[model samples]
Target: QDNAVPKQASGCVSCHSADGNPLVEGVPILSGQRSDYLEAALKAYREGRRTGGPADVMRFYTKELSDEDIKEISEWFAQN
Candidate 1:
């Protein structure tokens, strides 16, 4: 919520593609996951309740995102 405009839709879509890097070693797939689960995971990662590898990398990605961003991302995946 740093008052910055949300990143472009293309940015979000690029990495979350079905054929994207979701399963890359330690990366988590948001595609097809429940929204609640996605939110919880985001919260855990952002809060340090989760740790290690891409969890940490993903935590960094989630940390700076606004709650709205999380919700939008979750919804986007659910629809796809």
Candidate 2:
């Protein structure tokens, strides 16, 4: 791993951000969503109770996120 990348680089937004992966379709348009809801959904996905589609990719992603990170991403989407 490179020293320049932060430890939090495991986050989806770390690579799939607007400037990086804005082209991927059906990847939730996080912008303008409610923070609390987003946070709860992420938690659900992490716990395997909210499988998405047939593959449940969100579950894998959410599993890697900490509570603070989930809240931060949710809040970022909610505000911007």
Top candidate, metric lDDT = 2
Clashing pairs in 2: none
TM-score of candidate 1 on Cα atoms, chains taken together? 0.67
Clashes of 2: 0
lDDT of every model, 2 decimals:
0.61, 0.64
TM-scores of the candidates are 0.67, 0.66
Write model 2 residue lDDT over 1-80, tens digit each, in one string.
11232334345554345322344566666556688998888888888987647228777667778998888767666665
What's the lDDT of the predicted structure labeled candidate 2? 0.64
What digit string (tens of lDDT, one per residue) describes model 1 on residues 1-80? 12222353234444554433553444556556787887777778778888886667667677777778777766666545
Q: Give each model's clash number.
A: 0, 0
